[model samples]
Every structure is written in structure tokens, then in C-alpha cells.
Target: MPEHRSATTPRPAAPGAAAPAAGRGGAPGRLLVRVRERIQETAEAVSLVLDAELPYAPGQFLTVRIPGGGARCYSLASSPHTGEPMRITVKRVPGGLGSGWVCDAVAPGDVLEVLPPAGAFTPGPGGLDRDLLLVAGGSGITPVLSLAKSALAAGRGRVALLYANRDPDSVIFREELRELAGEHPGRFTVLHWLESLQGLPTAAGLGAPLAPYAGREAWLCGPGPLMDAAGTALRAAGAEAGRIHRERYFSLGADVFAQPAAPEPPAEAGVEAGAEPAAEAEVELDGRTYRLPWRRGTPLLDVLLAAGAPAPYSCREGACSACCCRVLEGGVTMARNEVLDDADLADGYVLACQALPLTDRVRIGYA
Candidate 1:
């Protein structure tokens, strides 16, 4: 099977794997972690080394509660394949509540409340056997760096990175990337595009430099414009659509840590006032099957949370795929979905936080 499928496809739980924690008010359980060290990556970006150890893939992210209120998701910069401590890089955004606190106020030894690692932007099982083409802009390099290092250190594949930034002063992990290139001259390659020297990237311009590696599996993350340009360039250079993956960069508008609002009544879903009572839903999660009442208008996440089922989720707004699950026996419709492409939908994936049942007897699995 193709490697990216693992990110969207559910698989059976391994023996001795930890079960999901029961939901707390429809939010994933939180962990309090101490900041072991803080590295100044750039003028506006800071990398926090967390003292906590948890199972996480290289490209996953942690949803952190802001010091005051609200929350933000920061991608992991450390690779689990390597022996590095868990770390997350935060780039300060103007007037950003979460980034501002972490960059300016957060100090070593400070305790932080964060959800466990969650995200679908990861290279799945056996993902590092083939050559990889990575593109990053600004802080998007965080996860890209993790994947690059993991491929170089643990896998047998060639890795190429095309990183763009405002200028030399703005490049994060410059020294480390240099060291990697030096260590693996044949297997690793780096290309830096400083906007200070080259104007904003264009598809036609980037196509030439990326043409050679266009056939490789490509992963892109950065600002929307940069990603759009890179994607266009790759496609023009003969990259297959299925071989390219993208990570959208966004800030959550709602606090995922907040208690989920009560679901609307069945009438809201066009169910008759005197319709039959809610039906039972069979949900498979963490190797356990749960029988819960499926409310007509209620989202699956809310029902599971109310029942104390251990369902996985982050960004209840459907902006992230942490709550993604497959519908095996029935159908569901999403109220709103910002993630999950057409291929993902065709493969039976749905965002549990936004899903409303379309069938009374629905069966779902988290693999």
C-alpha cells in the first residue's frame, strides 16, 4: 500500500498500546509539561524543548492552551526516530495571543497545558523508503525539518529541501540543516531561497530548480501563496497529484480546549417532533467497541464525549483532522470541513467533530 494511506487509513491497535483517555467535556485530555530548554531559532521564532515524553510521529502537532485563554497548535520539530527530546517551535505572529506568550513570556521551567500529539500531516508506516521532496516557507520548516532528519537518520532514502525565507537572518535551523547536508552529502540536499535576493517565488521560476525531484513524493507546508506556487511548479514539472501532500497553516479561531457546546435537538436536523427516540451507534476506538445513543442532530464527537468514550479529537471546528474516522457501515455529513481532500473523503474519512449521522445504524472506526 502507498505510505500516505496510513495517515488517512485506520489500522488495528498493536498489543499493549495505550487506550485513548475518556473525553473531558468533549476535549482531549491535557498534559502539564515543563519547558526544559528554550532555543532562540530566530528573531521572531522560539523552539521549546519539552520535558514530557509521549508517543508522537514526526509531523504531528500539540495543541497548547494559551497562558490566559485560547489555544494554538504547534508542530513538533523533534523526530521520534532520533534521540532528541520532544520540542515544538513557535513563531511569533503579530497580535497573536498564543505565539506572543510563548515567545515573550514563556520561560524554562514554566508549566504548559497541552493536548497530546495530534495531526494527519505525517509520513505513515514505511514512508521513508522512497526519495522525498520537501518545500517549506518560514516556520513551516518545523515539521519539514523533523521529517528530513528522520529520513536521513533512520531511513534509506534521498531527501531534498527547498526552503524559502525573508533573508538569512530569518532562516530557522540554518546551522542544523547545514550540518545535515555536510554529514550526508550524497543523500541530503538543501536549496535556500532568500526573498531578499530573489523576489517572491513564481511557479515558472521554481519549476526549473524542482524539476529534477518532481517525480519524488512531495510534501509542502508554508504560507498559502508559497504552497500554491510550489504545488503549481511541481505539477508543471510532472509531479503526480497523488504523490504530493500539503499541510495547511492556519490559526484556530475557537478554543479547542473549551467545553464543546451542547448539540442541537433532533428537530434541528429535520427530524419529526414525534420521531422515534435516538438510535444506537457502534463506534470502534482504541481497540474497544462502544454502543452509544446517536442523537439525530448531534455531532459524533459530542455524543462520544457525553458518554465518556475515549475518542480522539482536537480543533473541534473541523479545521484539523485529529478527529478523523472512517464510516464502515453508514453515512455522515459534515457541517463544515476545512481539511480532508477529495481522496480522503472517497476513502470514507469524516471529521467526527463535524459529522451528523445520515443513517440510524451507523458504524465508525478509529483504527
Candidate 2:
């Protein structure tokens, strides 16, 4: 019988002879950043810079967490090349908890926790060597400005920016964008759109046909209706579907149009108005179950936190999917879900921040 090779024998390494260590999967990176400066961009909007180095892509965003209040997502408005400092522009929504904290309580030298960058809105490879068109409304100019700055810094010259705001004073990064336009000369074009301009033309009135940049990539970000209008017009004017990218801000007004109608509850499961339930509900999260007092009309998230369960969450308005969790058992009614796709929802994924427990017991996990 022929001698059999030992199956358990380890292979020998080459001259370098180094072994690879196990990779840490999905570990969170935290940064402590102090506010370096803050400027009022508008009556309700402000731009802030941090004395910290945050490595991030052009269109990526950071989650700004306040001490007592929750966190909110803000797009990075400055380029990485600026070095050692990161800047983000924020627009305070009326009655917003996070916005009010950042505007009123946050000050220079105040330190805050910043999560690592996360987003899928960055520019693509096809954007290379093509004339770039950017359309922004209100505070949506943040990410667009970052992309433009990155492209210019990389020596990718052909670019144009069309920024729209309520008025000239509300335009974020006004001086910096103007300086960039001046530096690039004919290469960069900026169209300022003001709804209240007495004699000036609006973005819709710009007679310049989009045919000149037929093969160009277009980026749009703003309020839902404005972004929709700009995207529709760009497509109608011959911009390719694959080349047009967009991002939308959270809007209570647009939620009606953006969200699908919620499913109605069964007659047998009707909740009594102004009457506290006899018993509290329990939700199982991360191997621990917490009981929450059954308060009428209380959101599921509030109940979870009140019961001492640490659930991951950002942008409690239900727009961002950061707090997404999978329902293992039972049902929940979502007030709104702007981030999850149909396939995700079908897979039992739900935004824990927006969900209301429809039953006495629900099981969820941060899968």
C-alpha cells in the first residue's frame, strides 16, 4: 500500500512568513471632537467645524449626538484635504430636539461623540471626466459642495453647481463657493435660485438647455418636492438615469407624499382613547426583555428606552434607517419608513424608532 500524505499537515510559508490576524467585523469607531467654530448660515441654520480629524468620503455623513437629546445626521460640507478639522452644516427644523440643542447649547471647545461616517450617496466612477451638474435647495448644498471641492482638488476640472435657497443670505458656504467658482473660472458655474427675487429668474426659468451636458452626471439634494422637480426636469432634458443622484432632507410636509398609507388595525385590537391599558407590554431586545408601562399613544421607541433597553438609534424622526431592527415575532405599525426597501421590509426589518407595538409582546433584534 502506498503511504498516504498526512491530511493535518500545515503548509509552509514563503520567506516573508507572516500570518494574518482575524479581522474585527463591524466594530464601531468613535471620535471625541470639540467644536472649533460655529457660524449662523441662516435664521435657523448653522455651520460648525470640529477640531478633529474624521476620515470620510465626499458624500458621507456623521451622527451628532447630544448629551440629553438624541443624535442627528449631518452631511460633511468640507473636504478631507482641509486636514485635522471637519465641518458640517446644519439646518434647524422648527421644534426639532437635536437641532435646538446644537443651536443653543453647543459651543466652541465643547466635546461631543461622533460616529464613523456612513452613507451611500457618494459620486461614482462614471462621474470621472464628465461635466458635473449639481442642483441643491436650502441646506441640501452641504454634500454637493463637498463633492465639488473634492473634484476640483483632484484636478477634475469640468464642473458646475446650481444652488438654490430661500434667499442669498441663507446660502451656506456662500463665500467659499464663490471663491471656488472664481478659481475655476469658466469651468465652474453657479446659479443662485431665490424664490423671492423680484426680477431675477428662478431655477426653472434658466433657459440654458441641458443638452449641452447630455452625457454629464447630475447630483441633486434638497426638499422632496424640489429634488423631485429638478430630477424630473434633468431627465426630461436628457440626463441619463444612472448619472443622476439625489438626496432629500427630512420634511414633515413631504412625509405625507413620501410615505405609503399605514395598514389599519383590526376592530378587535382597537385601543381606547385616553385610557391606560390594564397591563404593560414587553419587548425583547438583544437577549433581554424590558417591560414598558402601557401609555396610550406612546411610540414604541419611547417605551423601549424608558424600560432601560439600550437600542441603537439616530434621527428619531423615522427618516434615517440607523435604528433598523428585525421583528422576530409579533407585529408593529410603522409611523413612517423612508429608508427601507420593499425587500428589507419583507424580510421582517422595521425601523424601531418609528414602530408602534401593536401587540402585548414583541421580539426584535438588531440584525
Candidate 3:
């Protein structure tokens, strides 16, 4: 064994060890953190260093709740491998609730509540020896940066980033990305595409940079069009069909979560106009079944939670697939889907957070 170091000394990781996990331990819940430091990345982008010690995977996100500004999910911006303060980047928009408050108001030592990190857009614990291709747009660079840094920090594989922005002035983490490329030498590379300077991005334009990386799996996060175009290009260029993964960014306003509203039943059995039928559910999880009161418009996850059923969920905006479950019986209607490719949908899978009960009696099982 190597000689023991003092308490203040930061020990090195064991040889061949992978980077720290990209997700925190245990189930998701609300956590309070003190703002330790705030670094401005651009006029609109800011990175917050939280005092809280959270064990989260790269590409995961936290749903932060501002005291009076409501809650919204933002991706983790720092690498867990560095053991530095956990950080999140926010690009504020005018009239925005959470982002605006965090960017324009919060400061060091201020306390804020945040939900535990929850997302499946993470690279697994497996030895990431394979090449990595990262494509990001606008604010989607947050999680991509984390994953790239973690992969480089672990000294596991080559990482390439193709970042798109409106202009050079609007690029977030411009300096950090340059520093990363410089420090890592040949292991890490980055390409910037500015719409104002290079015209709008195209499949051929983005595909050209990816040609050199013959055997790389891609992770995409950005606007729908960019992701779709890149996916098409990569697939056309012979990249494996399922090798390109994507994470969509959702902008939910004052409504932290959009729950399908259940109209209050009338005191009398005569009922009121537009009232939905009294629906019920049989939800199965952990080998047990629970009967719950469900309404047509109410989200299946809400109904399960209200009736004390153990249903897991995070980032109710539908971007994160934490609430996904299989509909075993009856029918459900999903309001939105940022996750779940066509195959998963064809398999009768639905996000419980966005799915509404369509039939009077339904059965759902966690997948």
C-alpha cells in the first residue's frame, strides 16, 4: 500500500478507476444548499457553486426552487471527478422566474432549496474507453460540459464537443472550453458554430466534423431541430442507430410542474359541467398493488402519489424519464414526451408524470 497522507492531502484515485458516479445516491427529494460562490460566464450565463455535498452523475440535473420564483430544472455544470464544489449554470431570460432570480438576484452565502439530481442522460459507470462525441446548442452545453470534463478527468477516452451558439459574444463557457482543450492536448477537442457568422447549422456542416471520429457514440443536447439534423447526419454517415442519445431542454414558466387539473366534484351527485368521470387506478410497484382514485385529466403520477403509492418521479417537465412506467392495462394519454423514442412508445411505455388516465380503470407497472 502507498504511504498514508495527512488529512488535508487529496489522495489520488486507484489505477484504472472510473470517474465518480454521475448521479447522487438514494431517491430524489428537496435539498437545501448555500450559495458558496457565483461566477459569471457571460452577460446572461452564471455558474453557482453550492456548499451542499451531492453525489450526482454527469448529465444529471437539479430542479431548483427559488423562494418566490418557483422551480425549474437546470443541468449540473461541474465534474464530480474533481471533488470541487457542485455547480449549476443558468442563463437568465427576461421575465423568467427561476433563472431570472438566480441570475439577477442570488449571491454568495444565500440559501436556496433544490431537488436532488435526477436524470438518465448520464454516462454509466462502465469503463468509458470508447470515443465520445458531444453536440450541444445554446444553454444545453451545461451537461455536455460536465460529461466531457468527467471523461477527460478519468483519462478514459477521447472527447470531442461541437457547441453551437447565436454568436461569439453569446457563447457560454468560452474560456473554460478553451482551457479544457489546452490542458488535455490531443485528448479533448471542441468546435464552435455561430449562426450569425457561419449561417444556420446544417446536417452536412455538422456531419463533416464527425467524419474523422469513426467509432464514437454521440450525446446530443439542444434544440429539437439541431438534435434531429445531427441524428440524421450521424445515422447517414453510418453511426450506429442507437448510438446517438439526446437530452431536450424544457422551459416551464411559473408553473413549476404542469399537473392535469382535476375538477372538484360537485357536492351533489347531479354534477357540474365539464366534470370528468370518477376514475380509479391499480398501480403496481415493488411487488404490491395499490388502489388509487384517479381522474381523467389528472396525471397518473399525481394520482399514485396522492394515494400513497410508491411512484418515482423527477423533473416533471417530461425531459427526464424518471417517471416512465409501462401501462399494463387500460389506456393513457401523454401530454408531452421529451424522452422515449418511438420504440419505447410502441412498447406501451409512458411517462407517468405526463400521462393521464383515459379509461375508468387502469393498471400501471413500473418498468
Candidate 4:
């Protein structure tokens, strides 16, 4: 039997809020334990069970730390009312470091350090008493699944889910979702979008069924382009801005491969001796400019971290694209990059963690 763990500890009361005096016991640590790790579709996705109680709102996400690497944010696949043992279904992308590791190497009894839930994906009171429409692609179903389950448990019966996948085999949580829809009858409807399946619905084919729920709150998630397309269709059907929410999931080290090599220093700027500063160095981020003091062979990320810039980053090894930023001005050189593409590199994108300033000034976005 697996033991249960709390997904989140009780939060301290607000300043003017209720009881509990000082010297009372502090809160316990909130962590999720790996109770079960099973392969769902070989090399594609996996189903994981955490021995923790995650009382998460419908659209929040948890940042799971990959030991010796970095964190990967994932939406809770199970609803809060499901009781102890939270669940998350992860889909593996080709050569994706974190997703691949979770799907291949992670095992039972392994503990995953998880940060508290965060994000504005959760819907408010307005979402209740109205038809709920969800549009998801591939693994983007995670958060939507949670929302659907939570809505059902709360007795908000008017809900519909449109899930798109490459094929039937790649459809995640297929049985569970089917069961949920079956239990709810006419109150719940799930449409499958299979690119490879015969007679599957396409973007245009979905217009009719989704049109009726155009006034409903719509939640969209998945690949960037796919989400954009769905949003366009939903809006055209009359869904309002406030009623639609979109969330994007980026791989940890996807941007490193997008940077070009740094230009060589001028002849006068030779390699420094001892602790002397380099002759030419500068870094720019998010429309703001910062001079990189010529530190002798110092890692660029170290300098940025020391400067107190809230640079987006995960897996400093250039494997995750979390640190990727656009080079609005100058260029940079990369130490290593397994992410990114030729077009991205040509478009002036660079991974801050793996880049060193080769010019005097460079502009980028901390965003």
C-alpha cells in the first residue's frame, strides 16, 4: 500500500483574519511522493501517481524539480476532490530532456520535489452556471482534464471537451476521460480530433457543435500554433475575450539552439591575465541595456544572476529553452545548445544561460 502526503500545507492566516496565536506549530513540508510510474504509450507518454494531496484550483500548475537538473511545470491531471494521491499525465516529446526523463527513467518510490501551485489559469465564480468549453491539443489535455473533473465533482454539469491528438494510441488518459463522459451522459460531451484516425473531426468540422457553446467560457491549451488556431475559431464563433483562457508550456531548454556564434574580439582586446576584466563585453535584455564588466572567463549566467535580474531559466545546461530570449539588437555565442532551430537563430533569439557576450552591447527581453 502507498502512503498519502499532503500536496500543500495549511497557509498562515492573514493579518486581520481569524484565530491561532503565536508559538503555535508551524506548517509541514508540502511535497509529492512518486507512488506509481507506468508507461501509457511507449516512448510517448506516461501516467504518474503522487502520494500527496494536491488541493489545487482547476487551472493551477506545479513545478516539479528534476534532481540534478531543473524544474518542469505540469498541470494536475486529477481534481482536488479526488482525495489523497494527486495524479499527472506527462507526454514525451522527441529529445525533450525533462519529459523524456520522467517517462523513461523515473520509477516508483522516487520522490519529486514540487513547488506550490501557481498561475492564473484557474477560472473564477463567473465560470460556474455556464456552459464550459475546453479545447486542447496533444498533452495539453492535462489542465483541461483537471478542470472537467473539478467541474463534475462540483456539480457544474454543462461541460464539453474537444481533445486533439496525432492518433488514437497517443490519446492520453483515454479510458478515464471516456468514463467521466459516460457517467455524465448528455451533460458532458467529448470530441476527438485525430489527425490520423479515419473520420476524425477537423478544425472546420467542429464549427457546428462548438457554435452552440460560443457564449460559454472556453479554455485552450497545447502547442502554440494549435492554440492560436483554436482561439481564432472560438472567437469567430462569438466567444468573448474574458471567457477564454490560454496557457502555454515551453520545454526547459528549447532556446539554446537558436543563437549564433559570438563575434571575435578586436585585436587590442587580448585574453586577460590573473583577475583582470576583459576588453569588450556588454549584455542587453528586454529593451534594457547593461554593460557586462569584462570578467575573465566568467559564465554569462553567473553574472546575470549576480546582477539580480529575474532571467527566465531552468536547466542551466542549455538543454532547456526556459532561458531563451530574443536578441533585439546584437548577437551572442553559445557554449552548447540542443534546442532551437535555424529560423529561431536567424530571428535573433538566444539562450542567456548558455551565451557569452561577444559584442559591447546586446538587447534582449528578460521575459
Candidate 5:
């Protein structure tokens, strides 16, 4: 059985490999894990149990590289506080190569190439003890369940879930949630919304059920419409905008498993002629610190990779939080940030792929 704990212990890169780029799978920063089991959660959803004991927080996701198909991120539903195998639930999307392959073709005993767990979706420092409001729709329930279980088992907070689904039979983790509720009757509450009976959820319609959780830390995941409505409803019910965190689901459009392109020259990439030397950045990654000259107008990830630093990243477009790092000293600005919420920004977290140095002598760490 996998060790269960609330704190994450970093997993070493696959033996004989380096960070993000060189791995046993012939790709940088990939690991090969065997499928321990395959579970059908619903008609369109399946959960794959991996036979590895690496550490990961509740809401973090794994980037799995399909053999012929590209990479796709799937949230881990298994709680680190629970003695369950590392598992990721995948729902087959109408023509999605990654989700479709994981759900329909992958089977027990198959080997998969995956990037280690990455994302800033996990609870922040001391966040586990705060009351939680989890709003999930469709397959968004995947990460929601993980956070709920982790909190119930490891924290002192009350947990409530407002889950929306297409219909009764389409609710993933139905029995598991019931068991959880039974285990912690006073600490756990679940409100279900079935579209077949209630029609599509609207902000006005969700106000009643979401009002009770308005004061709690909100974590929203699901489709665009559902998340938007939930956010609106929460805010209307008095939830502070900074207290609401969200995880957006999107398919990776770039090949994360491929080698990254060479960084452009500082002078060619629009550095001022004979301007003050580019800001200096001290990057802490994989237990080593490297100082590099971060050119203006260049993303931090580009600077790190160019200097042969073993930083992990996926989807340089900044939609995914795979390249998240924290600023310990100076500040940086993100060109585009689709994942981090206001709370994350307030906590000094930024997407390295989108970050440009805002001050000289910046220091960032990825622990």
C-alpha cells in the first residue's frame, strides 16, 4: 500500500534521468509507471491506479503522455491522507485523444510515461484547517473528492461539496462519497444538482444551496459555464473573491514531452541597446540554486532552461500551472496567467513560463 500523508515528499527523477527532459521513457522529465488496476467509475469515466508510491497533494494533477497521442493532465482523485494507490480519474471526451485513450484503450499492466505531479491547486499553507466549500461539475469532481477526503481525514475543517452532474447515473464517485459522508457525518455535507431534473444550473438557481458555504474557502472546478455560475453565486452570497480558488480544465495544445526550443538571444528578443544588464535571478530547483542573467522581456522558465537548469514545465502557454514557483525575494509579472487565483498571487506564487522579472535580483524556489 502507498504511504498516506498530508505533506508531499518529492519523488526523485526516474533513475538514470534528469529533470523535465531526460527520463527512462526517452523524454525529459518523464516517469514509467505500471497500471495497478483499472476501475470504471461511470459509463464515460475510468480511474487508473498507478503502482508507484510517489507523494502528491490532493488536487495536483499528472501529465500523462500517450503513446501516439499527446500529453493530457488528469487530476489525482486518490487522497494522500488515504491509504489508497495513486489514482487518476479520466472521463472520455467526445473526440479527445488523451482522455479517450486513457479511458478506452489503456488497461491494467500497461506502462505509461508521465510527468510528476505538478500544479498549485493544493491547499496553501495552513489552509487545510479552514472550512472548505467545494463546487464541482461533471468530471470536475475528480480533484474535489481528493481535497474533501484529505481535509476530512487530516484537517479540523468542515467540508461541503456542491456537485453537479448530467444525471444520477453520471455522478462519479457516488458510492465513495456516500461512504465518506457516513464516516464523517458532522464534518462532511454534499449537495447534488442533476441537470436532467433541474435544468442547467444558473447563478440565481445556485444561490440557495451555496449561501451556507459562502464564508468558507471556495474551490471551484468544472466546465466554463458551471464554474462561472458558481463563482457568481458564491460572490453574491458574500464569499470574498480572494477566498475563491478555481481549477480550470483544458487540454494541452503543445507537446510537453518534446524537447523545449532554444531560448532566443537577449539582444534579438528586444533587450535595450546597452541597457543596464538584464535582471539577475537566483533560481532554486531540485535542491540546487543557480544564478542566471534574466533578460528583460524573457520568461523565467526560458532563462532557467537555457542555463541547463532542470526545471519542470508543461504547456508553456500558461493555461496549466505545471511550471508554478514561488518568489522568495523579488517580484515578477506574468504575461498571462490562467490558473493561479488571487490567493495564489498573494502567496507569492507565479507561473514561471509567463513570468518576467519585475525587479532586479529576483529569487524563486521550486520545492
Candidate 6:
């Protein structure tokens, strides 16, 4: 029998790989994990392995807190079943505090605090028996790869990936993906769409390649446009909305695609005259109600968390809906949003990390 360690180990494994029967998931107050190692994946990406053993579903992400530098979320690229160090691949964002630190500063033995795994894209919605179509762009390959290994390993389902990158040298996990394909033979397939050779890859461009798996269930992660394009293409090819899942690395405010924020116009006189004062908030978590201080520039999630509320939040940047809550009364506005769609918006769901109250008093509930 393989020796089992006393603590959580995150190594590479398929999603279907077995894990310890019981383990503690690093909840909010317990986010500390020691960095075991850092493996360079590409010119811009590095994978960090943690010493702690925390069980998390595949496709979920951990909120990484850098002591005084605040927190950011990154999806776990390796499966929890590996019984090795838990691994999260970080792509260096040119000016990002979290990504920059992960890629440049973190090393063997370094420790970082990370919130528990949170996300809803894991397997079982359609079960592991159905065919799986994996789509990704740029660094978005992180979670898709995890999902791929999971689908393939879980039920021996056929898996195909359509990965888009800038050039041949830009792909993260290139060799590993190739090896997986080689190992799986007819069951796994991968195709690369390089911008240098074929221009930017879009959903419409995927029509021909995706035709074979038109009815297959798909999961996608990438920049906004890439995700939109892929989603459109998948829909055009007859994939049902129910069978497709999507997530973004950055919200529109953060610009996952690097599209610059438009220049702001000069402020006119009396700009504040009609501008309303900050909104007071009444937040409910687990049947407890607390009055929230609406700080001028603080995220609602931070406010709630600091107030001792078990406000679930990962990636306060508004991309992931880990902090999503039901709006009970009054109104709110998001600085940027990438998670909830029009229907969700109409239904009054808002990401607390991204939302700012618009009315004098806003009420939000976790349920």
C-alpha cells in the first residue's frame, strides 16, 4: 500500500482519483498553507504546491491572502486526490500584487493563507459518463485541465480540448497535456489554436472543430471575449445552455483580456450635488442580521467579513460568484460583473465583493 501522510497533500491527479475518506476543508479563519514547491509552467505561469491537506472539489478555487497585501483567488490546477502538495497554478499578471508575488516571491517552504475551496463547476451535474468538451484560452487552461483529468479519470469518458494561446511557446502545461493525450489514446484529444499562426481564436472559429462534440457537455474558462466567443460557438453548434459551464479569471473591471479601461472625462462642477451618499446596508448571514458600514471604497465582502459575518467570498474582483447573495430589499450596483447573467441579474443575485449599495438601505441574504 502507498504510504499516506498525516496532512493534506495536493499533487497532480485526475478528478476521479480517490482521496482520504475524511479531511478538513480550510475554512475562512484557517487559510494558512505552507508552500511546498514552485514549478515553472510557462514564461508567465508558476504552480505552487502547499503543505496542508484540505479537501476540495475539483474546479473550485482558494482565496490566497498575502499577509498585508490582501487576497486574490486562483483555481487549484491539480486534483486533491494526488496525496501530494495541493497545487495552484499562478499566471503572472504584469502589475498584479497576488500573481506577481506568487510568480516571483514564493518559493519552497514559503507559507500563505488560503480560504477554503469554493466554486460550483465541479462534476456530477451530468455525471462522468457523458462526453466532455474542454475549452480554454490563455491562462484559463488552469481549471479546464483539472476538469479534464477529472472527467477522464472519473468514468473513462471521452475528453477533447480546444486550447487557444498566443504562440507555440506560450501554452502552459503544454508537455503535460500532450502526455495525457498520448496516454489516453483515442479517448483524449487536444488541438491548439495559436494566434501567431491563425489569428485570435473565437467561438465561431471553433464550429468546424467542435462539430463532432456538438452535444457533449462543456466547461470553459478564459478572458471575457474568448469565453463569450466559445459559448456562442458552442450554442451555435447545438450545445444546451444547461450543459455548458463558464468562469472568468478577471471581471470586466480588471480586464482579463487586457483591454484598457476607457479614459475618464474631467469632472464637472456640482458632480457631487446629485451623487447620492454611500448606502447603509443590512446584511443577513445564517439568520443573523448585522448593520454594515458602507465605507467609501471598501468591498461589501470585506465589510461583512470584518464584521464577523461568515460571508463567503473568493476573488473580491467580481469575476467569481463566491460571495454571491440574494438581494432582499432596496437596490445595489456592481462595479463590474462576470458571473451572474441577465436572468440572474433580473432575479436579484449580486456578488457582494463587487456590489455597492445604491439605495439608502440594502438588505442581502445568503440564501
Better of 2 and 3 by lDDT: 3
lDDT of 6 by residue, 179-222 (tens): 88988899999989998998887767878887788688787777
Residue pairs clashing in model 6 are: 8-53, 9-84, 10-84, 10-85, 10-86, 15-150, 31-114
Model 3: weakest 10-residue lDDT segment is: 1-10
Cα lDDT tens digits, model 5, 80-136, are: 787988899988878777777888899999988887676656786566899999999
Q: What is the C-alpha lDDT of each candidate?
A: 0.77, 0.59, 0.69, 0.59, 0.78, 0.66
Best model per TM-score: 1
Question: What tens-digit string does per-residue lDDT give for candidate 2 at 304-333?
Answer: 655545454445566655455667777777
TM-score of each: 0.88, 0.61, 0.70, 0.59, 0.85, 0.67
Q: Please, what are the lDDT tens digits per residue for candidate 1 over residues 1-367? A: 0001113222222211223322222333566778999999989999999987766766777777875668788888999788999999988888777788888998998888777677776666677778999998999898889889989988899999999999999999999999999999999999999999998888987988899999998888787788889989999988988788888755577776775533442232225578655756798876679987777667988888767665666678877777778889888899998877787788898998899888778899875
Judged by lDDT relative to the true structure, which candidate is superior, 5 or 6?
5
Off by over 4 Å in 3: 1-28, 67-69, 125-127, 253-312, 315-319, 325-338, 345-367
lDDT of 3 at 275: 74
For each candidate, how many residue pairs have backbone atoms clashing (under 3 Å)? 0, 0, 7, 13, 5, 7
Model 4: per-residue Cα lDDT over 153-230, one tens digit each: 774648889888888887887888899989999888998888796444444666776787788888887776666767
Residue 39, model 1: Cα distance from true site in angstroms: 0.8
Error of 5 at 254 (Å): 1.1
Q: Lowest summed lDDT over 10 consecutive residues: which window, candidate 5?
A: 1-10
